[model samples]
Target chain A: MTATAFAFAPGDIVRVKDDWPERRGPAHIRTPYYVRGVQGQIVRHLGDFPNPEDLAFGRPAEPRPLYHVRFKKGVIWAEDRADDALLVEIFGHWLEKP
Target chain B: MNILDTPSDRLLAAVRDLLAQKGIATTAEIQERIAITDRASPGQGARMVAKAWVDPAYRARLLDDGAKAAEELGIPMRGMPPLGVLENTPDTHNLVVCTLCSCYPRGVLGYPPFWYKSAAFRARAVRDPRGMLAEEWKTVIPDDIRLTVVDSTADYRWMVLPMRPDGTDGWSEEQLAAIVREGDMIGVTVPTIG
Candidate 1:
């Protein structure tokens, strides 16, 4: 969807260019258990990742890009995966430019 | 100065004031419900697994989204955001640890279990996982299976989905749940009680 579609919500897809080499967790606010340090592209933008206005107890403001990062289950849970393919879609901020 | 007037004491006073205003039954009720337990404490996640093993829809939702899945079971996740649950099938086993800090799903799972927040467990788990398991929790793993320890932190929360134990074709939901302990949910122990 167009960024305009998001009004001031900060919408639009951007590719992950890189990740902090020494960070503890992923870059996103709400990261997944197995998605740390994983690389992927943003397929779509879901408004601002956490618009300030939508915050539980914070000032009203658009958060950040919350993209959908797709990963093969094989890459993540492959250590003991039963199936050859396991597909998962996680949020955008979860990824860094990589 | 009034106890309620101090700045540092304001938050606690406010809580007391609110409780008094509502005529809340007692501090015990509040304590029992709001107390923080270790995330990996002995039987924390065991409770959730017990709940899910008996409830089909709950199990499906847990497999889908652990945060909402937890809410459906009446677990409150106020401070803990972005919860994710992982399932362990016969072929795969999942373990959780926070190498950086003790970040856990306290809202749904309760306080971080003692072993979770311990420095020894933290340092040794990352260095020698197999040894830590055998020595600390007394968990023994076979040589064939692969083991991966997940790290929970500021941005993410994790839970393990344990494989269903065999042999009980017609066990009641409660019966099955009774057997799924917290250790199983953490990947240190398999579900054998039920």
Candidate 2:
């Protein structure tokens, strides 16, 4: 199946989608908890790939653009002394223009 | 012995047995895949890095297409995730981590170090990378240099192409490869001239 095209590009500021339904029990989720709702900048366009969330359940994945999202150290941690950066691979579906 | 098996290990063995029973994959094929993993090591990565240091065209290729560049060196990359080579420079340093799971470039760098797969490293590498670098790995980055941590959470796996150490101008590719540690490729430390 053709993958859904992504609108956002590298250098775009984005916020993680925080609307996932609350898990009833332990589930195989790829999105990290700390990044949900956090704002970050897209560092690179990682091209299209199968959505890993569906792949975990042995289902066919609809491909989506994955991006390397960069969050400043201080943004993630309040007490961080350095202004270093962290890049997380996030699927297009989990991000929105902020 | 059963107590020693982790849940994942037991699950893998069960899956393998079932697959074998159904004639989906022969035991030899399973063993061969395991052997391919075993044969992979840091030496394979070091050779690529060393070659890049000497050959500008090859370096460009390495950065442009990591898996194809590896194939130029006869590295088997089939069934592995796409590889991304991040270049380290005087102004920028690169570190790689997998926040969601232990996704790594096993085709080139062999098995990851124990810490690379740890919960603590996964979290801290993205949260406070500079602190983790100094306190845990003993590698210090100058304040002027920008540190970019690449998270290998998707289909593309990443490895750092570290800056060649100074004073190694006359060194052979083999000699250069010797000093390029697995940690250096992982970006926890820089390759130093010794």
Candidate 3:
């Protein structure tokens, strides 16, 4: 399969190898609010989940690769955190090999 | 009046009634959900972040027509009228604060973080976004990057879509989705590469 054809299945965690120069902050749709800026341990992965961007266009595809990312509450929430354990789900590309 | 439930209050009641009927959640659970769901339209701007991630073309469209674009994305932008997605570029970082009230994009994301609505955050986010972010979220934005603090209120709602991270190549959409966090989407957090 071509690069575009590479399927992102839920429950699988992979790394983002390139930087999108035009990206906004860590956006939320499939990603968790707490996982931003915190290195994630991929706990879930998926294949071809409907692109959230597509869902916004009223066209969400089948469930794609969704990963339950675990982050140290201290990492994501930092000083404001009340605990050390906070796990959240994010899509696959949001990760990079730690 | 506290005697009469607000729209969200009524919605919470309905949710409680449904939960009670289903025997899944307790009265406490219902109350928790209601309490957490105080923000009227947190999801409004989340739709833009979600959309921008999927379709580059659509992302462009969202910048042009945030409201109509949300409708196109199957997100109900009803009570929350206009939601805008502020792109966080390399040179600029965007932060959101509700100086007036806890106005946010509930229609798109779901709810506001308890701290986002706090008086302390409101005061600091406006007067000193860099300091507030560093002290609260632990995100130290470089001084070179322009920081724009947007107000979240009944009149206007805003969300930030931080620049996509580096090192994602030919990854599936789900893979891309993995790093997107609600805070990052709101400019409060940045996706970290592990």
Candidate 4:
């Protein structure tokens, strides 16, 4: 399947979407709660793939962009040391300009 | 069959039988698949790491594309998620975890350890990696070095390229591979001369 164009480039700071399935948790979601609504810098484009959220339901999924995001220390956890960072892979649909 | 089979074992039997009834895969075929997975070991990833240490060009290829590099070394990477290599240096350290689930580089390093899939490890690895390393594996990240936690919670799985330990200057590729361990590649422990 053809991949959708990348929305954010490397080094761009993007925020994760806070929206999640209300009430009970959804069956599948790649977006973790820790990074939800948090801002991180784009490290690289991890290539496009079918959305796992849709693939879990056996739906026809179009390929979408996924990016490697780097979050600094104290952003996710307060006990983290200075200059320490966290890196995560977040799909494009969950990211936006911060 | 053992009467002590857990619910998970019963669930597997049911699925296997159903699949066989539907002609999806025979019992023998499923057994072969299980054997293939079982045959996979940390030695495969160790071989790649040792070769990378000896060959700079191969190291570049490995950092560029982990799956292709493993394929170059005769390791099949078909039907696995994209593999990413997080490098460790003197100034920077990298640790891998799956906050959501155990999204591991199983094709290369075989199955993940029990601690990797534990809820406690997942949470602590993200919130207090420095402490987690120090306590669980006794691998302390010094203050001089920067600690970077990587979450393999998505499709892209990861493995660490641990720094070559000191006092192993003239070691051969095979010798280097011997010092590499499963935890070393997982960033839970560093390779020691022992």
Candidate 5:
């Protein structure tokens, strides 16, 4: 498939879809389990690229928008690390409006 | 020497044999790739850091597009993942980790350090980055300073543009580059002037 417009812009708060095991079936997923269902702000849209999940299987892949999402450490860990943050590169399909 | 003593050694040999048997890639080609990878080291990244410290234009370009900036310095970044550089400041510090695997800027930093690939590092980098840095590298990130841990878990690879150490003023770019160690670029340690 051809490249399309980005879904999320920088500063947009989005949530990761927690469907890796049930729907994705674990085929070279880049979204870490820890960030599943976590909300983060989009730092930047890193343009569209072929989905590595599909490319790993030698299948025809379509370009997907990728964004650098920043999550607070407190959101992912039990510790109250409000000053710490994690920047994750997540594809558009794995993200949704929170 | 036992070539296949370890699982990784055995796997490498088996894959090489299969590739050669199928004429997919020759053994010499594989060795050439290894040579290319080995030639890449933290020194390449240190040069970029040093140049950015002195040249504002270069620094802006480096922040805009790390791969292109690396190419400006004659580093061949073609065919490698897009390089993302996280700039460090007095108020904020940056660290790079691949929670999934050891995803790193191999084109610029050669290879990820052994500790960087450890399970403990991956698990704690995002959990307790400030604590981990103080414990392992003895580099403390003050509570007032924000710590940002980047997970290079996808298409783009990441490296830290560490803040230039104080008291290095009036130093040449090459001289400044000498003090920028591998750990500094990895964000495990900071570059110090001695």
Candidate 6:
């Protein structure tokens, strides 16, 4: 089956899908735990590429749009001391409008 | 010390031998791939940045399409991951990290540093980027400027285009390239004129 496609522009706020429980099994996962379920803004569209989550299991990779999402210091760390942003590349399927 | 004697190394050796025995891939082909990775260095990335500094049109193209722009400069980018060039301006700074793995622009910047692959860096880079930069890299971002940390997690790898250092007007591209270190391109530090 083909991969589900979604359009996301820069500056759109998105929350990463919290799939920690489902993804606990043995598989190469790329999403970091800190940013899961956190809200961030889309920095850029990194183009469509094969999903690594599926590719890790020796399955045919379904192409998905990867994005660079920027999270503010306050959103990520509870005690915000730095005035900078953190950006992470998240697949389209793992992001939702927040 | 022979570092390639571990269990993982043995597994890789077995896999390579199996592939060769099955005629799927030759040992020579495997060595060629290893050579490609070893030959790539930060100098390649510095040259691209120097060229961009001297040429505005080239800079535009480099930001627009990093892989194509690199190929135009005779940098072999075929069979490599897509490259994204992040430009650092006066009001903004860019930092790169691979939280999941050491995903880097190996074709342009060679191998990543040892610290880059560490779990500490992966966790702290996104958690406390400014603190990590200050304490680990000795890079202090001014309070006014916005710092953006990029995670190279997927198929697209990234590199930073640092701002041209002052007091280097009319300097040759080669001279500019001389001061552009790997740390500068990774946004761990900025380039300086001597």
Highest lDDT scorer:
5
Root-mean-square deviation of every model:
7.9, 3.1, 19.5, 3.3, 3.4, 3.2
In candidate 4, what are the lDDT values of residues B57-116, reduced to their tens digit? 999999999999988998878767888888899999988999988988988888888988
**Residue B44 shift from truth in candidate 4, angstroms:** 0.9
Better of 1 and 6 by DockQ: 6
* Overall local distance difference test of candidate 3: 0.59
The C-alpha stretches of model 2 lying farther than 4 A from their native spots are A20-26, A81-83, B1-14, B20-24
Model 1 lDDT at residue B181? 64
- List residue ranges in candidate 5 displaced over 4 A: A1-6, A22-26, B1-32
Model 3 chain A worst lDDT window (10 residues): A80-89
DockQ category of candidate 4: high
Tens-digit lDDT string for candidate 1 (A1-98): 43234232223233333344337642323343445665433433333444322363465544454443434334554443322222223334444443
Q: Residue-pair clashes per candidate, as listed?
A: 26, 0, 77, 0, 0, 0
> Which candidate has the top score in DockQ?
4
Could you tell me how far off, in angstroms, the CA of residue A51 lies in candidate 5 after the best superposition? 1.1
- Which ranges of candidate 4 are over 4 A from the true structure? A1-6, A22-25, B1-32
TM-score against truth, every candidate: 0.58, 0.88, 0.51, 0.90, 0.89, 0.89
Candidate 4 residue pairs that clash? none
TM-score ranking, best first: 4, 6, 5, 2, 1, 3
Model 3: per-residue Cα lDDT at residue A97: 60
Q: What is the TM-score of chain A alone in each candidate?
A: 0.46, 0.84, 0.54, 0.87, 0.88, 0.86
Q: What is the lDDT of residue B61 in candidate 3?
A: 81
| Sliding window of 10 residues with minimal summed lDDT for model 4 chain A | A1-10
Per-residue alpha-carbon lDDT of candidate 2 for residues A56-85, written as tens digits (9 for 90 to 100): 778888888888788876776787645577
Query: Residue by residue across B1-194, what tens digits does model 1's lDDT show?
Result: 78656787777767877896799745675565555433333344555676677677778888777878766755666545667787876555567767656766666656666788888876665445667788877887655555556545335567788877778567776667667766676677777742
lDDT of each: 0.57, 0.86, 0.59, 0.87, 0.89, 0.86
Best of the two (3, 5) by TM-score = 5
Candidate 2 CA-lDDT value: 0.86
